[model samples]
Target: MHDPIFSKSFTRTQRHRFGAIFLCFIIALAISKPPLHLLSPIGDAVKTQLSINNVGNMLLVDDGGRANIKPIADVNPAEYLQLPSDDAQNKRTSTTISAYSDNGIKMEKKHAIICKNSNYCKIEGDVRIDAKSSTILVATSFANMTKSWCVIEPYPRRGTSRVKKWRVATLEKNDISLPICTQHHTHPSLLFSMGGFTGNYFHDFADILFPLHLTSSQIQKKVQFLATDYKQWWINKFDKILNKLTKHNILDIDRETSQVHCYNELQIGLKFHKELLTLNSSPSMHTFKVLLREAYSLKRERVIRDINVPMPRLMIIDRKRTRVLTNEHQVLRIARKLGFEVVEGVATDLSRFAEAVNSCDVLVGVHGAGLTNMVFLPDNAVVIQVIPFGGVDGFARLDFGNPAKGMNLRYLEYKIRENESSLSRKYSRDHPILRKPELYRNWDQVWSIYLNQQNVSVDLRRFKGILVEALTLLYYK
Candidate 1:
């Protein structure tokens, strides 16, 4: 017979000890009201997003986001939908049309065409579709939002078709919507964007006479170029760049709108060196010196003006959706405003992003991966973030986690509305079409808040105070 007293005795003592420690911990936690919320689960999620690494068996998909198991139940092999091979429609089902040289050794052109969708008509990619598809590998299908208009990016080279034979696909956009395509025969046709001038802009040469139609081999060549010339920086940043490029290619890419914003070989290499020099020389960097300022009172403020576009003392913008400003353009505006020479940071690869950010006293941009550069910023840097007007992300992480050991982190956010959170949350509640809970929205915003949200408030005055302190410390570094 087991002694109940023994089991109860240890259990009781363990509970009592744990309870006592818990009380003390709670008391200490209350006293601190910690800025980082080290113990809060929300904080943990934040930390997870910002700094946690995925280990073995932990998969990352959707651009460094956590891996997930598909929720749909196992399919009955016999019942699975299958495309017919012998049927006329199925035989003509090749969505892609390829024009090759007589020798068949060369591809003259490969076009993906789409004649119609719900109420829209447009070319999706190099391939065209005459049928309706809810989601597509590339957004070549005509999709209607509140109204009908073609949306394109990276490169824009499509004009709405004048033909009245088709119309834009009806898209029901609202909360709980995962924008999809529909078909309509009567209405204004949306001539959506085209695709594949070059597979991806990263290094494609559609502009050249013998435009280097690209392949994995071509991208590899560019990667090699980066490694060879920018050897020092490239070695350290290759993994980051490779991961970013591959994932970008797989997801979040609308073959219709995706292109390399900049792919010139010369331009790519120069981007890194220019920023490295700038960051090392920037007065904004004095991480080592700023630490000592607390012991003695030192205040530094200098009049600044944007060299190109005048950026307010505090400017918040977004980057994920599209990067409209060039490095030099952006740096010139903000740095000049602060009385520094206009700065330009180039991106031959990923690390250049870090070098560029470290050159500034303050950095501002959207809730996109580029801002992840903040992780590499010199300690004592100030960051201003802008949430997308209608975008959300769950796994998106930024580098502004608890001020790196000796760093002081500050955040300023501006938005189209009062709602503040990661873009994932914004869309989760209102995707235009197929939105669901687990995958509907990244749900990341549930953890993130805008600077003005009741839960988190960051004002300009406080921001400037950090700048002032940062500037004061630069003299020592």
Candidate 2:
């Protein structure tokens, strides 16, 4: 029954069948989008071809507005990879396809949700706000089996410790259960929470305002806001800045509990970079400073670029709570003696305080939230942050020092002696709380003992030198 010629014939026929199947598979991969490379041997070739077609010759403009037509080689293919969609037959795709300009340059494609698993999601598409349930519903055809819903904190910081208290769910659009939109708008809406250390001025900027600026500015400030964890006072406080940001109203979503608000597009959370410290990238710090000045109607751009300008104005932030400058009057006296026009920053009302801070040439404060007003200071101004005794130089630097440098302001840190700290009254010289604060178990001890209970009676003679340094920097410039 085993004939050699017949056996050879069967083997050839089987080989032909396998070859046809493999060709069909390759052809299918060539037609399909996304993961096509994963299935094909010529993946790299396909990706390179796509890149050449999409991003090779792009016109890029530098800061001086010089447009250079350059071909960017070694571009990452992943960013240019076609976004996947579940419904291939649907005419209106879930995610907006990337459009090219008239010159064939690729534009930023609109996305439904760019998610990093269940933990963090940045949604920007046909988003609906169901205020009653505190749920954000996005209409997308890409809802998949893995995750159909996401829970987000809506704040910039997504760390578990920062966001554990607040939770908002982003759901896939469902027609049957979802409420009909009472209010519909064309502009993209920005959804965020005013929770988690909002009252503190430092957090007010770092956590909320700066991040909001980055997000809104990216879209050219053409957005509406839907705010949860509503605080009217907070709104009133920054009304100028908020009003400048959007032409539309900022709706308190929590207050609008019975209604569903919808937008043509929505960015469900604020964008932040580098721990919300520096505006290292485009929409730079200069842009933000311009926005601030325009918002507050501030005139000053710098601390008098001419060296002939006399007696640069100084602002001493007088803290009423913890970390009070016990010898602030003495400090003021010395500042006046140094040919400075001293004004006290009590910070009773922020909008007014912002104006005053802008008018000044130098800001002096104990290491606290009041120093956050340095954002309002003009360029080439100086900031003197008197660090309280407890070896919190790193914390002080992170919170204010680094940020000040990024804002184009001169910075000086005056580390107080143990005798200058109010802690000396409570703890002995040899006590671990004073001698070795590193031994403290956790943040609780760091906060309750060092940040909360501490006050600085800064040595007048030592502090004067720092203030003099600030004066010299401002006056000479």
TM value for model 1: 0.26
Instruction: Residues 181-298, candidate 2: write the lDDT tens digits.
Output: 8888877777777764454455667767887887788666688887876677678768888887887778877878777787766666565544335434566666777889999888
Colliding residue pairs in candidate 2: none
Give the poorly placed runs of model 2, Cα more than 4 Å off.
1-111, 116-120, 141-147, 159-175, 305-307
The lDDT for every candidate, in the order shown, is 0.27, 0.60
Model 2 C-alpha RMSD to native: 17.1
Candidate 1, residues 1-477: lDDT per residue as tens digits?
233444455443353344334433432332233121011111111112222123111110001121111112222212222112112222232123222222323343222332211211123232112222212222221212121222111111112121112222222233233333232121111121112121111111111101111112223223212111011222232334333222222112122232211111110101111111112232222332232222122232222323353332322222212322223244334344554433343353333433444455566554433353444444455565544333322111222232222234444444433233233344455654213322322223322222111121223344344444434443333
